[model samples]
Target chain A: MARVRERAKMRSTVRAGSGAAARGPRTLYDKIWDAHVVRDYDDGSSLIFVDRHLVHEVSSAQAFEGLRRAGRTVRRPDLTLAMPDHNLPTTARTGADGRRLPVADPQSAAQLDALARNVAATAIPYFDATAPEQGIVHVVGPEQGFTLPGSVLACGDSHTAAHGALGALGIGIGTSEVEHVLATQTLRLNRSRAMAVRVDGTPGFGVAPKDVILAIIARIGASGGIGHVIEYRGSTFDAMSVEGRLTVANMSIEAGARAGLFAPDERVFAYLKGRPMAPSGAEWDAALAQWRTLRSDPGARFDKSVAIDATAIAPSVTWGTSPQHVVPITGRVPSPDSFADPVQREAAARSLEYMALLPGQRMEDVAIENIFIGSCTNSRIEDLRAAAAVVRGRRVAAGVRQALVVPGSGLVRRQGEAEGLDRIFREAGFEWREPGCSACLGMNPDTVPAGERCASTANRNFMGRQGPGARTHLLSPAMAAAAAIRGRLTDVRTLMAEAGMGETQMGEAQMGETGA
Target chain B: MTLIRVEGRAYPLGRANVDTDMIIASEWLKTISREGLGKGAFAALRHDPANVFDDPAFAGAAILIAGENFGCGSSREHAAWAMADMGVRVVIAVSLSDIFASNAFKNGVLAVCLPADAVAHLLDAVRGGAGIAVDLEAQAVRCGGRTFAFAIDAFRRRCLMEGLDEIALTLADAEGIAAHEGRVAVDAPWLAMAGRRA
Candidate 1:
């Protein structure tokens, strides 16, 4: 009892003078990231103790293989969970030849097998492709309610920050770190200073969480928020649903911030209530009771503060290499001097060479060869609805090749298809495919042809990140769908206006209804 | 893992957004293990790969100079493992990406943070062929014979100097954990006995 009291007092003393101390509240991430600080180094970092470690096939295979060489077992198997996602084939109806897909390529097969062997050998809970609950790690973790508000979650995938939507201090780690977590369940981390980005105002029509994130990434250059943990607050966040919050947090890494978080709220509670792995009945009540306490004080301080009116955001799209190289669909390609920094200018120059775009070209004028509307970042049912609304009756542009829509999860796929979203896509010349990370990483057979330009909804467009020298223009699903029908980066608003869609309703339902 | 205070002043490399591929090209990805990564470190920077590192232009540059988000994308340990293997003691940057910074620390690569302005100043001096010294004990960096104080997270400093990783840190608490486990096993024998029910 005395020890508990002493620890509480110690925490209060330490919490003083930090940026998080500004509000009369504490953010769930602050509570979690700070609570797990095992020790502070003189270097201004902390050795954070990781509570739950999630591993995947692509990165964990090497680590477990290394452990075998060292004759070591997973040190804390109880705290670790394993799954395979990135390399899984997207076949709705599994057949014997299902394993022939590129995701099932020899390397990926070996990795999947090794992961199964290691997990079985170590007796850790695993969700393989065959597992009914299996999906993308980010999707599964939340669906299973394994990610809690006050825990630290680490995975080898960059989108691990997706878990931060639950108010967890989630960060993507490397293979060695996965090995380290498996062998110890603790991470030697350098603590990051917290930056509070308070977003106010109501979001505009057709603007989804993906657009908001893209807008933030554009404002704060890809690396502008580097080494900082962004705590998103304000009325805009307060109005968002749990799923919407997840989408915003998922792309935090795209802006170069180590992590992004929203304070836990009633929406968070309602989302986790009946989740498979969430605490049951009385346990649920207690969990909610505890989670209710997680929030930033009314006057928490911050290292930096950036505010933007959510109303200013539109259906944004990226015209260049990094996610930050973005602008609204109505905007034009930035001219040379628009990039004040020399490095950006050089990178932009090179990107222009590959993208084949003139400096002053309007974003809407640039044509696209392929259109991809899926990725863990923006492949949810809501995302599909947005795209469907635009493509419901509109035919794809004459020259468009392989226009595709891949849902992020099986549930999302089912929900979308049941609502006739698949019919909408197929009638409009879009290929309605199975749920998986299809063209997101080009790991599967779904890839952009070499030297061809594509408008993708997936995150990250580094040179050859999608394919060898494939020019990718990142955009919202609606934008991607609009481009598919127009064969160019056409503004979805103009397409909707022209299609005679949205005459009946003008708000949220219009987003759900057919645009054409 | 030896705590060798960076001796003498070395110039910052001053490259902006140096990616992992730039640090060690993908051609080097064929190798499975992280060892020998040092030999190929900075392979992309040199026009003639071998001559670049040995050239007097960057001779004895103990502290790497980099711009914001020094390491971005791809959570590859090879990136950090190679940088450590390349005899880089400290990576002085305006900022670092999360995964890269964590990898650097686990492998004993000290990532030092200075404001962007200070890094820009240091880069200017280094580009001029001025050397910089980073004293671990003094917690300061000296460039062109002028000393500038720097800060490090106290905990990471200890881990780097001691070469203690997560495994080692956990091992330090092994005895206590063992005792706790023993108690758990006695209190809830079924928990230990539980297995995959086929």
Candidate 2:
């Protein structure tokens, strides 16, 4: 450890040389980076220690293969959690007799079997396909409380930023970096700039947290937050539930941010209390004491800042291939001529052709053939409750082809069943299926058909994301449910009014109103 | 994975906001191996017979000029693997996604960010059948009697120049990693879990 001692000495010397300048206010990203740096090189690069690693099937198989080829063992198996979700089917994994079913796709089966073998060889903790805790890596990390505040987490998937909601720094790495972290629990990287995006004021009726994020992305355009880590602030985020914060943070990558963070507070601690992975009793108090100091210092300078008014946003959905192609539900489809940039105008025109829509068509009038209410983005217990509030006493429209409600995890499914949400969904003609990444991506058996339009709660609306030639419109869980009920894009606020339940009550976390 | 200068014919496919899914679709990602991804590079655009990737004129182009946000979605390194396997050594875009840029750097591929005007001019020059040259040591792109200077991280440039192995370099400092672990044990007691957290 002579090198470590020398580095420590060098660091202290630099700190003493800087004096009061080094004691100035620091942002949350700065504090976390400082705490995790193993060594700093003079060439603007640092060796960062990673605390947690979340592994999944699609992006991790090659990483495991790389480790095997290099004759290396996982450095810290205790800090890694592997789950098979991306390629696993959301169809019935268990029968009434509790016997497990075989995976129909040979490719998915082999990938999952390889994952089990790899996790076993590394002795890393794994939630296998049939495990009740097995779910999307992003969802399982937060719900299990394994993604603690003030920590660094890395995953092979881009949406790992979801853990940023809990005040952890979640980075989406590639397979090579995954193998790097496995061999050595450190990464050679450069620090990203810190940006503050504050949305103040209260949102209007039926504007869920999903809507807020969508509006933000639409305003910022694609690639707006590149090369920066965004810190979400202001009253709108402060008033949102932990689940809501998770939803918002999950889509930060869509806006081109490295990761999105919300400083930890009482809501975060309350959500983690008694969680399966959370420390309890005296340990809980100790953890809380440290986490309380995770906020950004007042007067800390940010490289960039954006201020948004929450009241100006409304329930929104994407109409084109990119998340930035969004508009309020009351708005009509935009014409290519409306775009000042020729490239964006061409992209808009091509998107309209692919989606088979005219420029003047209203959003609410666009017909949909399918509705998907699951993904790492909006498949939590809170998201399910929100959709159930809209689907409680309504039947799926006859014109709509299929409607599915896949929970994030087995625990979420069990909880939804306990709340009679399963019956509500089943009675309303929507299939209540098991959990996996499902139709959010086309990796599994559940895929949208070609030339079909679907209202999806997934994060991406990219071309051929669901399937070859599949069309996806991004929206909130409640909005997707409303679309399933009407066979078109109907505002959830309108349905809430028809049922005499105010939109404010539907926004509540407790899901109290089960309209019979 | 080292480079000093690359001079070759460049492909001019300036589509903006080209996401990773377009580079390599999810169907191609199921493979456990990283080899032969060249066939699937530009999977979506290749569906068209007139797409630049399949066009005979740019069949083996070593450089690709693209619009802003060239690689914007997914953290899949396969996007880099696909492009590298397709014989692309240099990618010049107005801007690139952070993840894609890092992945490209790791794969020995150079991601150059130039002003929009420079990129637009390069697109026209390359389409006019002029070759492009990138000099990393000089930090400049030369083509059509014009030079466009750029900046890159010094450490990254050195790594690319030396072809250093990142994982091996990190493992050389195992003592430092162990020291960090010792600190984490006391600071983050909740991190210990043998199996499932329960």
On the 0 to 100 scale, the lDDT of residue B7 in model 1 is: 61
| Residue A26 shift from truth in candidate 1, angstroms | 3.4
Q: After the best TM-score superposition of candidate 1, give how far the Cα of residue A465 lies from its true spot, in angstroms.
A: 1.9
lDDT of 1 at A427: 92
Candidates' DockQ values?
0.27, 0.58
Point to the candidate with the largest TM-score: 2
Query: Per-prediction TM-score, please?
Result: 0.84, 0.96
Report the TM-score for the A-chain of model 2.
0.95
What digit string (tens of lDDT, one per residue) describes model 2 on residues A310-338?
Answer: 88988899999998999999889999899
Highest lDDT model number: 2
CAPRI class of candidate 1: acceptable
Residue runs of model 1 more than 4 Å from their true location after superposition: A1-25, A34-49, A69-71, A89-93, A96-104, A442-445, A503-516, B1-15, B19-32, B35-64, B82-90, B114-149, B174-198
